[model samples]
Target chain A: MQIRKFHVYLTLVMFSTGFLMASSIELTQSTKKSRENENELQQEMSLNERIIAEREKNRSLEIQSLDRQRDISKIEEELAKHETDAAGLLANLEEARMLAGTVPAEGAGIVVTLRDNPSSNSQNVIQNIVHEQDIWRVVNELYAAGAEGVSVNDQRLVTSSSIRCVGPTVIVNGVKSAAPFVIKAVGDPDTLEAALHLPGGVVDVFDGFIKIESGKKENIQLPAFLGDAKVGKSVS
Target chain B: MGQNRKITFILTTISAIIGVMLAVQLQSNLHPLQSESRSITELRKVLLQEQEKSKVLLADISKQEQLLSQYQESLDSVDSIGVMKEELSRAQKQAGLASVSGKGIIIQIEQDPILNEQWDAENLPLPDPSNLVLDVDLRWLTNELLANGAQVLSINNNRLLSNSSIRNVGEKIQVDTKTIRMPYEIKALGNPDTLISSMKLEGLEEFFRSVNMKVTIEERENLVIPAFNGTKHIQHMKPIKAKGDS
Candidate 1:
């Protein structure tokens, strides 16, 4: 029985030793694998950290680009507004230039010719003559007809031009002019001509005393005001 | 029996070690990432890289802001010049120194037609002065037109301004300083409708009719009024000095 017990103990110890050796071998292989895995994890961790850092930089750059883009668009909008203002001011300047008589004007208008009566009596010459008042009366009628520009005997009549008689000769604008005054006016030709032919208009009133002729001209050109303009002459 | 008990103890210890080894392997396999940890150096490097990039971006932003302020400064200078240009243009328009175009009316008046039928229409002898259009008649017509809202007026081709005159010298008529003749065409710039309506008012039209005079009125869509051509000779009148003027 003792021999049998001894043999069983010896087998148990041998089996325990075999189990310990196998377990030890497995532990060593697992440790080697764990170490290799730790190295790989370290590499992966570094790669992941680099990716995070790059991503943060890209996000910051993207935000900055967006802010700059917004600022550029705002500046562009302001520049466009200023350009439009400049264009409007330039247009106003042109309108003012047109109004100053330094420029010639053209439009539909009328022409009137006046001559001394060829058939009037030689006796009582004063009654038959076309006097200065007769000329003034006709001029006044033209003004009522809405003539924009008026020129008499090729002499452009301006606001300050005056008409008067020095004896038998007529003085106009500080110069002498004879009869058969040809007055050209710029306006609507149809309206201007119609105004002249009224039943008892200036034309008819002078029918027996002076030869009056008038017609509508489709287009007429009036010279620019030759005199200096008082641009700063304020009434106040 | 004691020997048998010793053997049993040895087998129990071996089995306990095997159980612990299996449990450890299973735990590690389930979550490998949790088991792994990063080194401090790697984290520090990532922080340094991000901070450097931020500094560069900050520098770029400040440079852009400086450029924006410079553009704003130029805009202010342009504004002052624009204001001065506008003031000068307004004055030119008001001086009647500028040519103008607008809708208005034209009126024409002539002498008595009876004088045409008979050279001596009134009495027995010569052409009567009463049969002709007198200077008074023209003056009356001009005043009527002014009352009727004629903004700009011209007689024949002579533009009449504030200093214009209509007078009679002998039997002829003088306007401004020039002699004008019959078949007179009067041009007035204003609102066509208002000017025509006011001209046809009762007493004025009735009186013109009673005199056996012929008057014509017509509307024009576009009329060009000439700028004052005469020199600006301000003899009697002088401009008032402003408080700031020397």
Candidate 2:
């Protein structure tokens, strides 16, 4: 009976051990398969999230592009408006010019000539001659006298005209003009001449020191206008 | 004994199934993460492109603004000139002025001989009076004439616009890109008697005498002032807009 019991016990132990080993192998294989499936699901989720994010970014970028285009369009419109306004102004200016007719038209006026008096003392008597300031003074007087247009040595006086002193010569519009400086204008001959001949008139001031001749002419020819007027941009 | 073995086998199998599910879930989660990273990177690139485009557009806008300002300025000048012309026309009509053309007076001014003689011999070089015909003098004379009620002033053949500049370059004077000589001729439209009489002020005559300069004033009933020959360039501070249907 003891031997029989021992055999039965041995058989039971072997069977249990074999069954346990098979079951453990099966469990491990099943676990590994399940884990692989889970990983795949997680990967899919990640992909979906990435797609969603990309779509959002794309949408935002598109919106930005649209805004930029809109801005550009607006700016173009402004430019167009500016162009139109400029054209209108030009037209108005032309109309005014037409109404005024040709500038520097015929009128009654006086012609004044200022020059450096030759030295009567000696050949080397270049000591005192007409100074540039004298010319400037005379010109000032003419302007003060209501003289309209002025020209020195045939050079027309424009808005951009510059008169300066270079050595002993008076440079006007880049040209050296020496005495006698002839000034001609077309306006009220009597009134214009009077303006220059007044007590403080440019000509009157230089009368005694310089040779001042006052006369009247039937008609005087004023030169044509020259040069362009450049108007600067407004900051405001 | 058989029953115990069967139970052990069943437990092991269940554990194996659980392990497999876990592994599968982990793998799936990892795939999604990888995909997400790629998508983010792509989105970043798109954002960069958008930023670059915005910058370009901004530059264009800035350039347009500058152009617009320039166009506006031109318009202003045009308006001013128009007003001046209208006023001038009215004044001319009211004055009953007649067209003038012919030879006029030739007034000459020179430095005073006495003054030159008085100069100290030590100051050998004396200032020349012939060098005073510059933009300042011209501008002064022009202003004076305007003040005195004389109209239609022109220098040489160039018409004096409201916006003109007289600058000196080195020793040369430039007026509207044209070079002028000495002995300026000033013309105006007004009453000669009143104008001439107004010029005989005390200081004026005395000043002329002191400088020994000759100033000749001649009145002409008929005088022809020439038109301006300078080019008129289009100037606009702002972009011009199209006009409404004409």
Q: Write the per-residue lDDT of candidate 2 for residues B97-140, one digit (tens) a residue.
A: 21323332222344445556666455656656444445554555
Q: Alpha-carbon error at A205 in model 1, in Å?
A: 1.1
Candidate 1 local lDDT, B83-102, one digit each (tens): 42533344344445455667
Q: Model 2 interface RMSD, in angstroms?
A: 24.8
Stretches off by above 4 angstroms in model 2 are: A1-104, A119-128, A234-236, B1-246
True contacts kept of each: 0.08, 0.02
Q: Which stretches of candidate 1 lie over 4 Å from their true place?
A: A1-100, A121-123, A229-232, B1-94, B97-246
State the lDDT of candidate 2 residue by residue for A119-206, as single tens digits. 4343443423566556555554554444445566665554334465566667665456667677665445676677666675556566
Q: What lDDT score goes with residue A41 in model 1? A: 59
Query: Which 10 consecutive positions of candidate 2 chain B have the poorest summed lDDT?
Result: B237-246
